[model samples]
Target: MEQSDFYELNDGAKLPAIGLGTVNIQGAKGVNSVLTAIDAGYRLIDTSTNYMNEGMVGEAIRRSTVPREELIISSKLPGAAHDYDKAITMIQESLYRLGIDYFDKYLIHWPLPMQGKYVEAWQALIDAQKFGLIKTIGVSNFLEEHLEKIIDKTGVTPATNQIERHPYFNNNEVVETNKKLGILTEAWSPFGREINDVIEHETIAKIAKKYDKTPTQVIIRWNLQNDVMPIVKSSSLKHQKANLNVFNFELTQEDIQTIDLLDKGEPGRVEGQHPNEYEEFG
Candidate 1:
């Protein structure tokens, strides 16, 4: 995207359509990986307390030739820090670790609805935004109820909802819900994380062959075409560049439908945890 791409969030903030995900990337290698993404034209970079690499992400920001204001940096609050006081501290701590003044966006990593603290956490995020600690605030892994709970209690809708989405599990229900709410849906594991199960699918392979592109490119494009921002992770520079090169081709509506048809519902979830029951201790 030479002109670069952006999406107008519900909160009237602009966010890049495609972003780099820093999951396993850590330490010096992680720093280099994030730097590579910045150098490769990724304007948005996603990090999280759960990911445990805010320091490296911060270092990459320092080393990048791109101006700090030009890049949109995001991080998340951990499950352990859902309390009002703890959530506020974690937001400040993330900034301290990143050595940045403020985050472009920040999210609650999980709803942890069972604890009934997510709404309370949402209140903390609102306070942080008012304090100018973060430009935008949202949540991850939130189902419909989780989303409504916060919005009902606080009257603040999240700007985005990051979730596990791929061909194997389209999660269209959540996607459409986000759509109606005017919330941008971000796909975390756009490639299914397990890799082979998604990219190697017969349907995706056929479309890839038709476009003369790898299944990876097709997936990223699929996310864009579906109005979903994809946060993809790649350690190699070549793959990072290749991931963003998807703009040249367009998938036919029929192809998009066929791909969506490949959804296996809950059976296709790659990550073992369901958002509702997941109790994150780490």
Candidate 2:
């Protein structure tokens, strides 16, 4: 899709509806993958300190012909760096590694609720924004309770909430909560980690045939139609181009409902890490 297909965040910043996710991809391969996606018209690139490839992403951006202002670069603070000091250091490190002056968006990678420092981490993010180290700040893998804690303590609602969402695990409650709070909902594993059951589902397959698109495209379109920006990862140029080709079609109301019925709630969670119960610091 064109860069204009961006959704306005709560803070009035624009985020591209579709982004290329760089998780587990690193080195020259990662650089090439990101460059390919950018050349194919993707304007947003999502990475994180946990991904360990912000350097590669930086290299891609540096080598690309695309202007820095024309791209929306995002990275996340690691859970290990959940305190104010560590969070500040990590944000600067990400910028240094990305070879950029500021991030289009910076997110707290996870709540790490068990560690009990996410509120402080959120404060650090707010401070980074104030310093112009980041243009927008948000969270990932944060449930409603975690979100409320930060908002209540800081009076600053996140610009967006990135979560693992797919047809199998819709997480409608979180999406609705973000919507109510004017926070955009971003879907991270939009294909449910390539679960065969979801990709091979009858309803998705039928809709794919009707739209002359793959189940992957139909699913991405489903996210867009539902107002959730989807970050899809692919190392292959072919798949990268295919993923961005989804903006041309529209899913019917009945088709959307059919996909909606695929939701299995918590049982369908691919990552299986409940934010409240997960406490990993590294």
Candidate 3:
């Protein structure tokens, strides 16, 4: 299996198709997980300051032999860090934590419209990228209108948009719009938040049996087929290895359509703050 399948960003940077998400992983556990993943040939590591595990992630990176250029490290500015100065400082701090000179990608974690500073924060991101603080800049949990607002104001399209996406909430409209705008769609909770019921749905299980794969494998494969970067989280070494085992099998076009019918067109998890009620944090 290819350890590093590539996905093209709007800016033309190619990201590894799969990443190990470090949300909620912390302390020694986090450090070990990241080291283990890197040692296993995983090139992408996703973490956030809010995850509060960048220090451990940094430690793991230092302990590994992979050079900085070979790793794609992605972090985000938390909602409270939306102010320009604070956002810039937070990013620098994150780099310090990760023991890296610059991030492979940095994102506005969410658009808090009530705070009314994300546009400025977005500008900060652009400037940071220009300064080479990060190689790519993007956002997370931003819907279409929020994305359009930033593009209109700054004329800088986000390189990608990471969102809660899975079979149950495909968000194809958003994906299509992102394609039109040259932004890549990234799936944060690619397994439907461990809602294993989706895995057991008759259609999925039937297809899985046919393919000799698990329901989880089917979902990840579906994401790859749809051209979305799928971030799968796992603390267990066994499941971590299992998650990456998605490359050998292929989901047919018919299987893809069956999964497509699972879209409920509703928000699944981590939908961003409403524009009117956005809050500030630092």
Candidate 4:
């Protein structure tokens, strides 16, 4: 990763502009993929307890040539462990699973507002950070209301907010809100999963051609240019390499404007789970 491709969080921690999102890949395959990405110059790895791959990620880190301190490893607290006590225990369990003493970053996987425990969970995260178990703390799938509630209650703002953001569903309002709060916006599913049309979109293709890059590369560059850190997942070494190769070129202002117009608002949300209504817990 280039020195220019990193964002400084509110806590003064630096995060890679692009991270490997370990969602479905598991076991030896996941380990190898992660190792390959690290070898290919990826310094950030994003995983979660819900993803059930922290163990694999840990194994990969152990086997890789990269030192643990050089990599930014992040995990999330699952909705199943929303209470303060459960959140603390779950983070410890995740640390044990990852074979690490401390995480560079930890996040609440989702607000699950209907459960009404995210504020308490946030407090647990704050305590964990104070305990030296986590270096930086943040949240995922949290909206403006969720962010405000937690900050208002604890007087501690999250270091980052990970949310589903792609060209089709940029969620500009949330991104702006995070910016105003000094919270870095980390984009999950930055490529608009299963939406082949985005990769094949005329505007993206045109921009890619102009920059002599792939459409995916164009989109990733767009995220960086917009000050959004994107977590992109790919099991294939080829795709992973391609994803990391995006920093070489710059996206034109007009091209970015064209992609911006692709936003479809609510209908463009790929995950289909609203933060306010998603209350599932184990």
> What is each predicted model's overall lDDT from 0 to 1?
0.91, 0.89, 0.83, 0.90
Which regions of candidate 2 are displaced past 4 Å? 1-3, 194-196
TM-score against truth, every candidate: 0.97, 0.96, 0.92, 0.97
Better of 2 and 3 by lDDT: 2
Query: What is candidate 1's lDDT per residue for 186-255, written digit by digit as tens?
Result: 9989988865578888889999999999999999988899999999999999999999888888999999
Best lDDT among the predictions, by candidate number: 1
TM-score of candidate 2 versus the correct structure, residues matched by position: 0.96
Model 4 misplaced regions, further than 4 Å? 1-4
lDDT of residue 270 for candidate 3: 33
Q: In order, how many clashes per candidate?
A: 0, 0, 1, 0
Q: Write the per-residue lDDT of candidate 2 for residues 1-282, one digit (tens) a residue.
A: 443677987788888879888888999988888899899888889999888899999999999999999999999988889889999998998899889999999999889877899999999999999999999999998988999999999999999999988999988899999998899999988888847578788889999999899999999988898899999998999999898888678888899899989999888986546777766544
* Clash pairs detected, candidate 4: none
Question: Candidate 2: worst 10 consecutive residues by lDDT?
Answer: 272-281
- Distance (Å) between predicted and true CA of 49, model 1? 0.6
Candidate 1, residue 214: how far the Cα is off, in Å: 1.0
Error of 1 at 232 (Å): 0.4
- lDDT by residue for model 3 (1-282), tens: 255668877788989878889888999978888877877667888899988898988888888899878999999999888888998999998998888899999889878776677898999999999989999999987888889999999999999998777888777888888888888888887776656467678888898899888887888889888888888887777777777888888888888998998887644433443334446455
What value does the lDDT take at residue 219 in candidate 2? 93
